[model samples]
Target: MFTPQGPTLRELAAQALSSVEHGYDLLAPKFDHTPFRTPDSVLDAVGGALRPMGPFESGLDLCCGTGAGMDVLAMLCDESVTGVDISAGMLAVGRERLRADGPPSGIGERGPSVAWVRGDARALPFGPAFDLVVSFGAFGHFLPRELPGLFAQVHSVLRPGGRFVFPITAPPRPSSPWYWALLGFDAVMRVRNALWRPPFVMYYRAFRLGDVQRELAWAGFAVELRALPEFGYRRDGSPRCRMVVATRGGGATPV
Candidate 1:
């Protein structure tokens, strides 16, 4: 929910008219205050899920707006946690936030290192450097067609047997009002994109889990869906949210 401190309607409209990168730049300052930011519950849940697999040497947070996922990396990784985003303004804010969080959990992980890099997700700058890669709340920015490239970028940057982790929620059922709300939102975005320039690409229904699973497999990842017990199950007995652990080099010969 948008609060009094959040971006105003006019500001949001202006952002919607701007390029995805520029819009995020414009919104960076107020992003954490908005509902758009990943909630603490989700963050803590993901952190708990990754805790057992921890002591990872290096971790990367892809599209790490305001560095929310950075907290997870800092907790689970033993050395070097990095954040990458296309928006410089967002990266700047993320760095500042990390600093304020204090020693180990914040920007102070520098002995082992905590850094921010400005880069596009499609063509990540590093090569096979991260032991674990995580992203949160940024997938709506990528269209369905871009998932293959995005997954490939993640795969390319992970060391052999490294994992790319992200959470996926169960889609709302058609009979639910939430589903209709999302459908309406996507419809509005399509019309907005058709009429607008600089296209702010965000669609709630675009990245279906089944399609994403297949795409991840095609990108050379052996994808596994681990139920996040923290979020509980839906009426149908499926997890409300699942942590996708996609491992690279699963089929490759050891060096």
Candidate 2:
């Protein structure tokens, strides 16, 4: 899944041995070349799904590694877009990508301004200053127990009725090969953490939709699910991908 520009096997081993923050810092330079980066297709799908609900003002991209989600924010938000990450290296690369790529398509000549901040997702450094927040492909770094705190942080950063949106894929069935693959991946990660110092937390199976929905509600969000038609549905007739729109209640804002 990794391209030639991606990290070497030895380099990846070194990163796997480091702490999560430091590991991402080391991998930041070649991250987009790796399969770890969120696919453009997913980004486009989310952006399309959110367009009708948006026209949002200020937006935040929580755990915004390499600022992939910021592109979507630029398309949806009118004023400004901020990307927060724990890794300085990742933020630096994100800034470079912004500079090189310029504004995303569909944004006007006076597109939303962009900024990068280095901060943990559990304790964001902003007030309730954002109208919307979006994240992509960064949840696995957080353990299952951290969901409440993480969702709370997102809630705290958003204005009342503002949305905290992210796309989640339906879990693979027990009969599917992907199910066993992810199960084995999580098992390996558990063993690695058991044996190593400064754990690099990345598990594929830990973030379940039921658990996440409950945590979002506890964190004070009225949650809704929107199917992304682009990815289609499973043979079981469930959506392959759905966007979770968690609105911090109290106001009547449509989104």
Candidate 3:
């Protein structure tokens, strides 16, 4: 589902054939017009949930495609925010947007100074300089087996007591159309990766919340889940969307 300004079918096909980094580079300019961008509503909800817990001085947005998650960090963190991604094209677009939009308004005399760096999330290129870290719609690019190292990387970049936060939706029931759609998408991706080189790893069904929580804990995070009331609850009375707040403690050991 894309708007008229979004990438054409031909462009998308070309992107699919490229490596994940290159594919995102090709898609970066029109990304915000596509369904792939994290929705403003989701970002707002996460901001609201984190507001009470912060006044954080420094924040980082992991896998920050076009810097959407940085908006949330700017609202919560007063000092500075940094966005890191593997795509130089995405970072280029993000830099242009920042220059045009300027600093976000209403956060005192100035909002946080923002910077974009090209770096992989698996090995973030910074010290424990951040009090907060956030990611949006990027975890699907990481395989299930990479969860441990990924979480460890996030933990390593966070100051003690700092949080690695992100929103996750509850999986659809087996009977739901969405469930089948995601299942099919993952199956197709698996087949494509098997047949192709420089695999474009984007599997909708692979990033389960339970597995993620376990990995976060293993990475020495004191994990907590907070329900996003804006999304409401499911028929089973469980939250339809929840924010995972994994805090790095003193015991965190980098891999």
Candidate 4:
């Protein structure tokens, strides 16, 4: 669902027909107003979960649309934080927001600084330079086939023992309305891609937990899932949401 400030139906239709990058570029200005943006609650939960693991030196926000994940990085990392996204329009909005917020201060001589980089997630233009990396609500942009390469790229950019953290909500059960809604969305997306140019590779049901864990392991990450207690549990007693923390294999790096 979208707000009055969000993209109109016609604008959304135009975006859907465009390439993923162009679609996001068109949607960038109004992205934060849409339900598609990562919610503040999820971000806060992630920040709280990551605080104990950090005091990290440098951080990266992968696929950082409008830099929402940068807030989590700022809380955990002491030195600097970089938000990377493919859309120039998104980066522009992110840069302006960060500038307005100013650098975060406290706990050290240098406060956390924010930088925006425009680039593809599959081919990140960075070395093993980051002590922590995080992405929020951006996984659907990559198809299942792309997960391996995407995780590998994140691994490449992280220092050994650095983490790639993100929160994942448990899939809705078959009886749930959310389940049918997502199924319908994926079905429509499939049809749209079949009949249109520049396919948008976003599918709600495609990113299975088992497959994702296996791919992360293959990409040299030791994975763990921490339950986000703020969201409570499902009827079966499983966590409603969990934060996936994948640390690159090796000894822990100094903060």
Query: What overall lDDT goes with each candidate model?
Result: 0.88, 0.91, 0.91, 0.88
- 157 Cα displacement, candidate 4 (Å): 0.8
lDDT tens digits by residue: candidate 3, 121-218: 98888998999999999999999999999998888888899999999999999999999999998899899999999899999888998899889888
Q: Which predicted model would earn the best TM-score? A: 3
Better of 1 and 3 by lDDT: 3
lDDT by residue (tens digit), candidate 1, 179-215: 9999999999899999988688999899899999999
Clashes per candidate (backbone, < 3 Å): 0, 0, 0, 0
Q: Which is the better candidate, 2 or 4, if ranked by TM-score?
A: 2
lDDT of 2 by residue, 1-255 (tens): 999999999999999999999999999999999999989999999999889998999999999999889988988998999999999999999999878887677456788888899999988999889999999999999999998889888888899889999999999999999999999988988999999999999998888999999999888899999999899999978999999999998743221
* Candidate 1 worst ten-residue window by lDDT: 103-112
TM-score on alpha carbons, each prediction: 0.94, 0.96, 0.97, 0.94
